[model samples]
Target: MTAETQLPQATGSCCSPGGACHDGADATTGGVTAVYRVTGMTCGHCEGAVAEELSGIEGVSSVKAVASTGQVTVVSEAPLPEEAVRAAVDEAGYAFAGRA
Candidate 1:
């Protein structure tokens, strides 16, 4: 599939007041939202690993990973410490490219 096709759309409606997704219910606090560039991810396995790792992070409520671009977008109910996110990526054997 094409790169565009490979990317998973953000789950639920994000910006609409009447959207299914609840606002701030699953979002990060401190006005901090991040899209991290995760390296060493080549396939579903990598994606799964990254997703799983991020899921365990405290305050991290949602994570969407795109393997083709090694990108992971995370949303949390509270501001997630960057160190925590970085550790997740590193522990998963992937390189963290900081916020993008």
Candidate 2:
């Protein structure tokens, strides 16, 4: 099988990973989606690390990171309190460069 066929697809609700509900709309209570651009991301590993960091937040529903552009889109069950997101980025050794 090709690499594409070998990878397992992720299954998640609107609140789960890789779900399609990240347009500033709340996934849990149907609130709003929050998109942020992170800085200091340069590769797939950086994206993975950032995604992992965001995923650890309590209210974060999912994290999509595009390493090429250093962009990170996050969906939240509720409003993503800035401090929380910032903390995650900081812990991951990156800088949260506001929303893009």
Instruction: State TM-scores per candidate.
Output: 0.68, 0.70
Each candidate structure's count of clashing pairs: 2, 6
Native-referenced Cα lDDT, model 2 = 0.69
Locate the minimum summed-lDDT window of 10 residues in model 1. 1-10
- List, residue by residue over 1-100, the lDDT tens digit for candidate 2: 0000011233445655634464655444354456678888887778888888888887665677886777787766677789998999899899999988
Over 1-100, each residue of candidate 1 has an lDDT whose tens digit, in order, gives: 1121122224444554423234334221322345789888888878878888987887665577888887887766566788999999899899998876
